[model samples]
Target chain A: MTARNLLLGLLAVLIAAPAVIGAYPLAVLILVLHYAYLGIAWNVMMGFAGLLSLGHALYVGLGAYVAAALYASFGLPALLGAIPAAIVATLAGLGIGALGFRFRVNGVYFALLTIAFAEFTRILFDHMGWTGGSSGFFLPVEHGQLNPIALRGPPVLFYYVALVMTAGAFVLARSLMRSRLGYAWLAIREDPDSAAASGVDVFRARMAAVAVSSALTSLGGVFYAFYYNNMYPEQIFSMARSIEIILAPIIGGLGTLFGPVLGSFVLTLLGEGTTGLLEHFGWAAPGAKQVIYGLALLVIVMVQPAGLWPWLAKRLRIGRDG
Target chain B: MTVYLDIVASGVLTGLVYGLMALGLSVIFGVVRVVNFAHGELTVAAMYMAWVMAGSLGVDPILTLPLIAAALFAIGYALQRHLVEPFIGRPEHEQFMLLLAVSIIVLNGLLLVFGPDARHVAVDYAYDSFELGPMLLDTVRVYAAAAAMVLALGLYLFFRFTDLGTAIRACADNLLGAQVVGLDVRRLYALTFGLGCALVGASGTLMVLMRDATPILAVQLTLLAFIVVIIGGLGSMAGALVGGVLIGVSEALAGFLLMPSLKSLFSYGLLILVLLLRPEGLMGRRA
Candidate 1:
């Protein structure tokens, strides 16, 4: 009961945060929320279903390109364009999952397959001229009055959109966790052979996990395109981007409701904080933040394999409801 | 017709060097059963080592191969003993993450040190070419290919005839059986990793002769290595060379026939096809 109230109170605080905080902090908050949303979506496949996808940037790039293309070509706003974008991404995931599961490309090979597909798509898009090719795809910016319908507005507007996404994804993840599919996913994850013996639809369950995860992640991609107003094939679909997506779930505590959110917050803040410190100290280093991320991943995996959220939850005496 | 022959001949040379790179990966996987995701980064690291050594010592980059090989072997052995040994029997994801993390660190560390600039050795024969009938092959590429072949032959012989090589093969055949036979599995794994890194180091030394050494090349090289290894079949040394030649030829043809950018498209397409049609690869045994 206390946790629920605390969550609602925290939600209220976030809703009112833009009024108090500066634009930079609000922007940071927005990035945190976006990553949190992506992490939650990615958690469905990797954390719950035990399918480690190293190429989730494939869906992100797909969603971004699809919606961005529709907007670029037809002037259809991103709000409506998100549907086809998500569908396209989901179909791609389904294709990959179908091929992998059918062929029994288990463990590391499945991860490699995902990478191959993502790299293949990235190269394909690199030469695709219609969507701007290697140059980049850009959306027109409206500087003056607010345009909520078109998703053209200030940082505060994006903050709220990101907030809604993070909260909605949290709710969705929570509900899925309580569902039969989620249980089956856990069964399959723990022991696929035993799960099969127990009458679990292992293949379908894994596919569903991939579908939901990809669809939700695509929505995050939609938000990314509109918010950034630009999409670069190299940056959008790079392995670095995929690593960023997975880091949160892995670091926060896989399969936990609050893990992704917590992990996102920690990662974004730490990354930004390090960059800020570097600036303050007049240390001009480019890949310092990524080095931090790599070090953090190594430390987290080696020291506390369960991740920070579980450890924090235990210390704070929080309920396992998360 | 001559142009096509020239491209094919050049690609075969490049492919031999690529095979040496993939040979290291195959050797490591065959024995240790842990895929080094950082293979390309380590290769780039070796390239940098060769580049720096050649510049400082005012010697040919080729001369630094043995020293770079020894250095990389030491690094690989230590890396395996300390970092990778724990995750030997653990879940695949853990090992993947460990190496992925290492890759990121190595890549970014290179970026920080090298500043994204393409560095190359100003070898005396940088522009020299050799002619074989109608085919014109770059002299450096021909030498690199010859060097790669020699190294590959050395590795094969080491595996076939050496006592330590037999012990390593025994370990790869059955870990439990090797343990039961009182072989030190940890040391052998480290030695195998060291040998693998040395193979790649030699390739990297040769690769710098063909292309510039840049941090950006790490990921592409890693993917290229992966494509070669998969196409050749995992755990098959000879398969690595065959896959390398196939990929090398296709890339050369694609560059001439299609677009240079589309060369990877063909390689990746081949990778997907191989995964779907023959997951075990051209020469890999089906487990």
Candidate 2:
């Protein structure tokens, strides 16, 4: 069983699974994939580079809003709009990465600083009338259910599209992790001073990783808006949204490529199942979902602080406990 | 001039309350190095407790400080000793996840128990106003502000003078060193958290006097506290106070000077600017 064969087989099943799952289930899968992509993107900097960012939602919102505004105002095709939006977001991420790494603001302070940048952007969007301000901006909806080539139209199409994006993201991250740059990231993660001493350009490495991670995350966001046919500052540029991206990777396995996908699956399935169960029984509350999610995090950490991926990997004889 | 003076006065008062909230956060971080995302929720709970106590005992919530603070102190100690203490030496990332989880539980638990409806603290003098020159201040806001200032000062003095305070500060400064010096680092950890909770209770009481109590205050107020903490400097008491003052004034001035809807945005923008310029915060020591 070659790794490439395994990957191809998995991709094939994913492409087909959406067609069978129908619209409602596929929609859920697409949301999970979006988060999975974001998790992978964020894991590049946060997990691999050992920098925590509580505000990566900024990139996501920027990507979505940028694409939507460009398309709606000028009637531009999304294929082009999405690319530019992602580049803008990537540039923003680089700007922040430069500022933080230059000043040596690593660890928790870096997380807080990321959050500051996000909130700052949210405020700016709230005031920028051209971005539709606080009322929000809506993208043109393709009403009729049509087949999409890149998973852009029907829920099933979106699911496959998302699956491909998430799959590509995972493969890219995994390969990158095993490369020289990846080793430099690992060294930076272990100890920046030592990594610097060993000839690793710690600052440049972190900044590069952040730029790529945020750019990819923004690309996910661009797809997110086109898929939903809407964009809003409050929803996209939120601390909660950032948490959504961070949670998946952390839950699955912070530094692992497969972690985000596993995390998204577990969190989404568990959340949906629990919510479905509750809705059926009429046991609904405003914030109960968050409570349940929190409890899941607590339970996971207490029992297996190493995260779900590592735990499962050990059980499957794929890896031994360190 | 009168309007400006009134705003500044009000902002300073509000700043005192925020300072109290940030103080607890700083203390907890100082001791355990855990960000304690649940700190805001605990403060909301304290406010609820104060409201409940006032209603049950027919005492002014302002007067019920001792009881509320004591009860909250115990709750804080218990939460720290049980939930947070276990994660003390865990990997930094795991600790954040754990704290975030606990925060979510506490927030939803509050919603479940109290529901989504805003809970108002019924006080006789809540609306009474006190006038000085051409400026008028709500009596409760004034008293709350004054009480908060006194409490903050008292706290500053306590941390500066008392043996327990010194030990806690010692632990905060260097956990390993404190243990080597025969300080019960565990007890100091719980004490620091307990003190933080007590201060939060006081802050909650003051907040109720100035604003309505709601479950979602946990979320909003926590964000505000984070802003204050970051602006002031992490783990610095004076920094929290100064940060609180600056945020309060900036929020007020931004609302008046700029778009009415963007006061929060303005303060957050300031935070980013500060980070870009000085990542250690306004008054924080560089690591």
Candidate 3:
């Protein structure tokens, strides 16, 4: 089957899922799609541009805090608040990218730089009074404020919104992968010095990747805040959170378009399944999900290396390049 | 002022332990060219082991040092030989991701076994402090710092003068060339990794003297070690010590002058500044 057809079929099933599945399963599906959105956003930078940022949570936390604060302080609509959140996250990404790229801090050093920035922002938020500091910020919900258009409604409503966002992100990623910028990002990823020698403008391409990826991630963050109705700096801007964002893309297949989406679904299901099994057996496994993720990554890296999605794609003859 | 001098003194002492924390990471990276993301977890595991020993056998945390070091050396050797050695020639990203996966597995495995609660080992002088003229010093901190200094110096000497250490350095400098010179590169890699873990184990035993052991502490320590190593230069032992002390003093000053929460901010800020302005670090040769 062609990749396009496979994606369309998946979308159809997802759109129809709310009708057949119970609320619990729908919530799980929402979580899966949430990760899919994040994974896709991360793939653009790490997979395509060869920029490994282990601290992408900086953008996510920034978007969440900004939208939540806007709603709480200025009584702005949460949907409208995402615009400013995206802008802020984009600017932050550009600043960080400029700092690292201009100084020639690539590879592992670049990843560490991203983590440091995220840590700095987390500390800043932890002490900021208006954002509620470590106490957390809660959004007020009124009796008549469950507007579907504004993303303030039931799980089903939010589920559809999440689906639309994920689909939109998938389309954006697909188009970007085919554009001139995408080719430039691939060249830079392979060899930046050679790419520059070939007149590809390495720094600009990298900065653009960071900017686009950060903006998309911020949108996911805004969605996360409204869906959860609260924001905690410790929870949102955590190293663990950043790790979780990258695992899907890596496991699905780095540098592939469908890898993040497929990986997110696989990981979320396995994670939820393991937790359910543990709960059913009356065992309290506090870190079972992480254990599963870690093991999967280890096994994949040791065995397949290219990730499950690309391997499966090759076997099934769906696409020549995942 | 006395306050300034006291803070500086405390910083230098704590810096010794931080320096020790970075030593193992530096050595591992120096020999194999692969950063061990699980390096911090090895320390956390050793701390837990020390805690268990102290609680069950009624021994001091310091007394469990030999057991922790021996056990960690074995684990590190086995890990490198079985898991990491195969990927030494792979792409750098694969190596990094593999180590990261190992870190996640070890951290979560620890959480599964020990739960999420923080565990600490109590010693006789945990809270005892002595006045040094105008300043006060915790006896436990002083002892831990002394131990750290000894270990750092020992490692420096080992790398400087020992035959095996010279072989390890040669492997780090040029892998194929080292092989051409008839060095048992694989065995040397495993030994270097084991030695690195032993150093971390020693630091972990000292850590139990001052801080609580929790699963989450692994990632924090890893990042701290990275900051120190980056500031000291990736594979430079002397750089790790100077960078560690500089970070320690800056953290103390930040906590004193600003909010306690901003201590990490100061360290991370300095890290970014160093990476931007001088990526070679204080004692490291320019790349």
Candidate 4:
């Protein structure tokens, strides 16, 4: 195959993979897209801007609860509620970014700070009665499933929505990487002092990263709230969720375009596959899968330092135009 | 008045153990730039080890301290060399990703190995207690506190004067500079991690004496240790002590004054307050 045809053919295969795989695989694809969307947004900070956030779940959980609360109490459509909820989350990230940067808190300290904010938010939600507290709040999937609500459509429609959102985020990050602001952010990431001395507005660029990343992450959360139809502190804001977000990027290859997507696919498949095996042999398997998951991550982190995506791409001789 | 005094005394006792747990965390963070996400699981591992040593061999839990310490030192060494040290010099995000992965694996590993059932040491400490006036304090709790204090003080001295401890601290302050000066940075990293894990083992042995343990406790204790370390200020020995007592007293006061249901609220709320008020913690250098 010629180079151009090979590239196009690969693209076609990616697009057609979910459609050909049937409903069960399509469901997995939806989860992949949702995770990729979040991972891409997270990457915009950790990967591109060099600001680590261990509590990206703060935005996801808060956005979800906000959207859920609006629909439940105000009887508003989630489409309308999603925008404002996202806006709030963006502002929250913006605030956190400002505080962190103002103090020159980079590296692990910044990661811990993000965690502190998210944990505090989780605590607040856990105690609050209005949004259903620890018992949790649910969105009516039945209502939106009918197509009138713009949210509760069929699994196919939701899958398509997630795909589009993930695609949009990928495109956004790609362009942002090429933009002047992107370069400034990269410069700041590499050397904050040198970047500032070179006339880069370090604060503004970092703030932009935080704002955009936060807003996109909230949109992913909106999908989560609508698709699952239920939300809880432990499920939404747990450290596990944060791990899920970062894993896609980390395993995919930090700062690489398709890394998060590939990471999400591999990790989710691992989880789903392990879970299925456990369920199939309940008596024999029990909790063995968890140990496997942990061991796999440790191995990957240590041995495959570049993550799964880049490694796989090199093996397949695909996607890496470089 | 009597009830208030009892509450305060109990809070102090609980705080001592908290202080001990935080000391290990502080030392590790001070030397290594990474947080030991699996530190709590190490504690749980020690708890199980203590249970086995005591239960199978009919050794007293108190007498098994040296065994716990030695076993934990080996485990900590292996964990550092095989599990953690490979990712040590990477960027902060990479280190975090690695440690978190290890944490997940270890927690689940314990699940697969030990099953989900919570186990207790079921020793004399479990039933022993001291009654002073209207207050009742468990003997294990008081013993654990006193033991922890002695051990923590010993560790403090270790850090203050020992050559190896100074090397660990020097590595923490200037990684590249220390390596240039011919310090065996790799060995230093391993020793520091082993020390940290060993300290956590000390914590778990005591915690098991006072209560039961499960695999899930690792994640929970890790979170609490995160809070304690942050409040104590990362890398500051004295900070961990103050932070632990403060958190303990705060929790106790909240437990007594507010509805018993709000205890967690008070703990996390205080965590947020500490982060906001003094991000450096009480004694940590300004970040």
TM-scores for candidates 1 onward, in order:
0.97, 0.93, 0.97, 0.89
Instruction: Rank the models by DockQ, top first.
Output: 3, 1, 2, 4
Worst 10 residues of 2 chain A by lDDT: A145-154
Q: What's chain A's TM-score in each predicted model?
A: 0.98, 0.94, 0.98, 0.90
lDDT of 2 by residue, B151-231 (tens): 888888898999988888888777778889999888888888888889888898778767676776786677778778777
DockQ of each: 0.64, 0.62, 0.74, 0.52
Worst 10 residues of 4 chain B by lDDT: B278-287
What overall lDDT goes with each candidate model? 0.89, 0.80, 0.88, 0.78
CAPRI-style grade of the A/B interface in model 1: medium
TM-score of 4: 0.89
DockQ, 0 to 1 scale, candidate 4: 0.52
In order of listing, the candidates' clash counts read 0, 1, 0, 3
**Candidate 1: tens digits of C-alpha lDDT, residues B1-287:** 89999899989999999999999998888889888999999999999999898888987878889999999999999999999998888877888888888998899888878888899788999899998877899999999999999999898888889999999999988889999999999999999999999988999999999889998788888888888988888656788898888888889999999989888878878777777766553344542
Q: Candidate 4, which CAPRI tier? A: medium
lDDT of 4 by residue, A1-322 (tens): 3334644574576577766788888898888889989999999998888888888999999788888788878877778889998999999999988887776666766776787678778767888887888899877656434663547778877877887788789879888988998889889888888999999989999999999999989988888898888999867987768867887888788777778887887778887788777777774554565555566667777888777867877776765431
Of the candidates numbered 3 and 4, which has the greater TM-score value? 3
Query: Which scores higher on TM-score, 1 or 2?
Result: 1
